[model samples]
Target: MARPRAPNRRATSCRCSWTICIEPDQGTRVKQRPGGMPPHPSQVLARRGLVTSLTWLALVAAPTVAQAQFGDPGGEGTAATDTGQIGAAALSTPRYMGADHNRLRALPYLSYRWANGWFVDGINGVGYGGSPTPGLQMGVHVGVSPDREESDDPALRGMGNVNRGAELGGFAHQRLGSWLGGKLSLRSHLRYGSGEDRQGGQAELGLGWGTRLGERSLMNLGLAANWANQGYMQTYFGVTRAQSTSSGYTEHKTDGGLRDLRLSLVVIQLFSPTTVGLLMVSQTYWQGDAADSPLVQEKRNTMAVAALMYRF
Candidate 1:
């Protein structure tokens, strides 16, 4: 698979903006604006309202609690914190890239640190890695690639479903000192998916800063870029002549490049010594040919998740 460089564009100059929102429940707040501007008008009305409403509803309907992530945005690996910690989280996200619908997911979070400087986490899937020094960590992980149903979106009327596959990858994290004496981290992930033509892997890199709001609360802000390979680009965004005819979209031949930039926020509140509440929100700005595809109805999208966790 070809690895193309991201085009020189104004979009590359944009940076992530972070805001700290504190509540009595020890919640964290995060909002992202790509290019530091409002979304395109066409997108504002199409999926913005739905995203906002769904997120708001989840926050209100969910129990007042928070959960922890395995390799959190703060650059701290969950296994390094508490070895035997175990918990679960329910996430709400869109079914597909440009879909208007959302789905609910429940998954467990686990971290086990062995005596041999090895660890495994359940949140992002089984992995072996941990923070070896004060600010550096590395690990390898293998996990299932969640499948996508073409029927989820009307625009994908004829596109075949993406089969569930596997991905194995490695990650590295480096701490960028602290923010106001709080911890900050930079992390990156490289993963290869199992597909004949989509054999190339994906790469992600991000910067994050985390702070303790109080004795029982923690919050993190993160910004990252996602790059796709030719196989991946074509798999999801490419439109063949037959597909174009069936899906009513023009043939779009996509090359590997920068797919999108993402900003994320994570907040965790410990309700009790063993119970926690978490809220995470992320915003993405699609770029290059990925955004130019006819299947892409909204170039900018929002994803929110609220979960309650109990550590045993």
Candidate 2:
């Protein structure tokens, strides 16, 4: 009886005395801080990050704008102070020709950017084909790039005796777009070498793409279509006396199913003015006619050079 009486008293107290704060009444308003002030640390950090990001964006954009105006020849406006709206070159060709495949060589080149979108290059190779023929070669190359500055990479000239015999001609290059290019050149090796005995030549045309591999190299690939030229084809796939006549030390000859291919790799190492190292390779495949003479079934060539560059 006593326990039941206490319970009854506690229940009555719970129903009357329970007190938990509920949400404010509907439409009730909240109070202001009395005075606006700076936000918390998180808010401040977010604002600072936004400001920092904007600053970095501006810094990145500034160089692009500058390059557009004064530096990139492939770009527009011709803001170069040297050109003064006339649009001139920054400097002459930094590289010259020397003998890599033969005993002596003479490679002459002339390149110009016309007012029109097209660019022009003239090339000539003079020498006795391995013999000292005093031969002549002349050819021309033309193409359009976004601008001339885009073609400034020196590694594009792979290893080859561009002019073989007494021929007259030049090499040609054209930029089809930002990522594609093409070239053609023709020559006649009428006579080359100390004997001055042989006579022939080939016409050449090539298409290629400029692309990046990984983050370390710039690459170029020329297609089989370019070698369709008879002259160019022969210059690459043809067998020379050097190949036909065995030195006894090494015998080499060529076979059938002629082919010529070139690939180049360039690496840019950033230092003071930035350093560039290049590797260029040329390969030729010949089929048939390989008898007694060590004909070249395959010919592979490689060149490596490192150069320091600065642009003003």
- The lDDT for every candidate, in the order shown, is 0.54, 0.23
Worst 10 residues of 1 by lDDT: 42-51
lDDT of 2 by residue, 112-157 (tens): 3322223322221221111011111122321211111112223212
Q: lDDT per residue, candidate 1, 85-167, as tens digits?
A: 45555766655665555567775555554423354444335556544554466677665554556676677788877775667
Can you give the lDDT of residue 293 in candidate 2? 24
Using alpha carbons, what is the TM-score of model 2? Answer: 0.31
Clashing pairs in 1: 65-277, 65-278, 66-276, 66-277, 66-278, 67-277, 67-278
Q: Say what the RMSD of model 2 is.
A: 27.4
Q: After superposition, how far is residue 57 of candidate 2 from its true place, in Å?
A: 38
Q: Any runs in candidate 2 off by more than 4 Å, and if so which?
A: 1-166, 178-198, 212-217, 224-259, 263-276, 287-293, 297-312
Tell me the deviation in Å of residue 186 in model 1: 0.3
**Against the true structure, whose lDDT is highest?**
1
Stretches of candidate 1 exceeding 4 Å from the true structure: 1-86, 104-123, 194-198
Task: Give the best candidate by TM-score.
Answer: 1
